[model samples]
Target: MAELAFCLPDLPDVRDFATAQAVQSGMSEEALADFLVAVNEVATNAVTHGHPTAKAVLRMWSVGRVLVVEIHDEGRWTPETPPGQTPPAPHATSGMGLWVARMVSSDIRFETGAAGTFITMSFKV
Candidate 1:
């Protein structure tokens, strides 16, 4: 397992952390690309949309051939629409992250409460 505690300005480092963990899990070249895409999108949302002054934690682990990543943030955001359920409009500029995450990752889950929000994604490595 690997973990990184990051802030908004540490987005690049978040990618590095996730890349390293995915490599260690024996992810394939093609799969790694998709995995990073999802990681970048989710991590961006984590640091930017989460609570002010909040610290985000990213965790990566493997179970058999599955690679699991969890991004946890100290925020209580209610989604305006069900996230990752549909792709963004063709002309839309933003709001593409969640939908893209769903397309590339095998499984994506969201949870929020007084503790914060947890986005758990899984990839088959």
Candidate 2:
């Protein structure tokens, strides 16, 4: 597995790096776009909603024909309900990041606690 651990200032760089890593790991062109979109959305949320000075760790790995990417943030924020459990209201602008991520990824899982939140997104390779 490969990992990129960073703080808010490095969000963009991490996104680019993660994309490159995913492509290099044999992700298809279509999967690459979708993976990048999902990564950006989750990473953005980590920085915006997470605690001040929070850090994020992005890890990528492959198993069989599946590619897995996990984004972990060192913040205490927790959602009242699992994101994307239901579609967001139609006229809503925000609150769609997780929904978009869910739509693009093959599978998504979340783990949260007093320490932080960890989101794992899987894609078919």
Candidate 3:
């Protein structure tokens, strides 16, 4: 497993770290680009929206042919609408990250409680 501890300032670091792990996990060229985009978006959401103190952790690993990347924030939240269920309106200024994540990742799930929010995204390797 590969892991990174990050905050808002570390957003760019998150992408660099995750991209390296995804490549090692054997993600295809096209998929890897999309996967990195998804990873960045989710990581951004975790720190900026989920955590009051802006701390988050990201972990990546592989099981069989699937690559899994998970982001965990330090606060609890449940969205008013299921995240990524629909695209944001054109005039909307934000909330497009999760939607982009869902479009690219093979699957995604959310688990939130008093501990925090964990977003697990899977990609075809």
Candidate 4:
């Protein structure tokens, strides 16, 4: 098992994490691209919606053959439309982030509260 942890202030850090993870994994260029996209989508969501002053701790570890990443944010979470249903058009932008995450990640689990939000996304690495 391998694990990495980082506390990121904003978007750039998110991109850097993606790059570092790809390089460290020695993944194919194509897989790296997907990882980058996934990280951006999730990190952006946390920064833009969850918390502005909050710090995000990203942790990655291997479980057997799968790669798992957990993103924890110290920010309040607002209620949104449920998954797998068409949300209102005005709220489309909010949902797109999650949609992108789902596209690239093999699995995702999220828990939110007044204190903060925690998200875990897994990939078949």
Clashes of each: 0, 0, 0, 0
Provide TM-scores for the models: 0.95, 0.89, 0.93, 0.73
Sort the candidates on TM-score, descending order: 1, 3, 2, 4
For model 2, state the Cα shift of residue 14 in Å.
1.9
Maximum-TM-score candidate: 1
Q: Taking the tens digit of each residue's C-alpha lDDT, what string does model 4 give over 27-63?
A: 5677777777777777766666656665666777767
Off by over 4 Å in 4: 1-9, 78-94
Q: Which stretches of model 3 miss by more than 4 angstroms?
A: none
Give the TM-score (vs. native) of candidate 3. Answer: 0.93
| Better candidate number, 2 or 4, judged by TM-score | 2
| The 10-residue segment with the lowest total lDDT in model 4 | 1-10
Ranking by lDDT: 1, 3, 2, 4
Q: How many clashing residue pairs, candidate 1?
A: 0
Index of the highest-lDDT prediction: 1
Q: What value does the lDDT take at residue 29 in candidate 4?
A: 71
Q: lDDT score of model 3?
A: 0.88
Mind sharing the TM-score for model 1? 0.95
Q: Candidate 4: give the clashing pairs.
A: none
What is the TM-score (0 to 1) of candidate 4?
Answer: 0.73
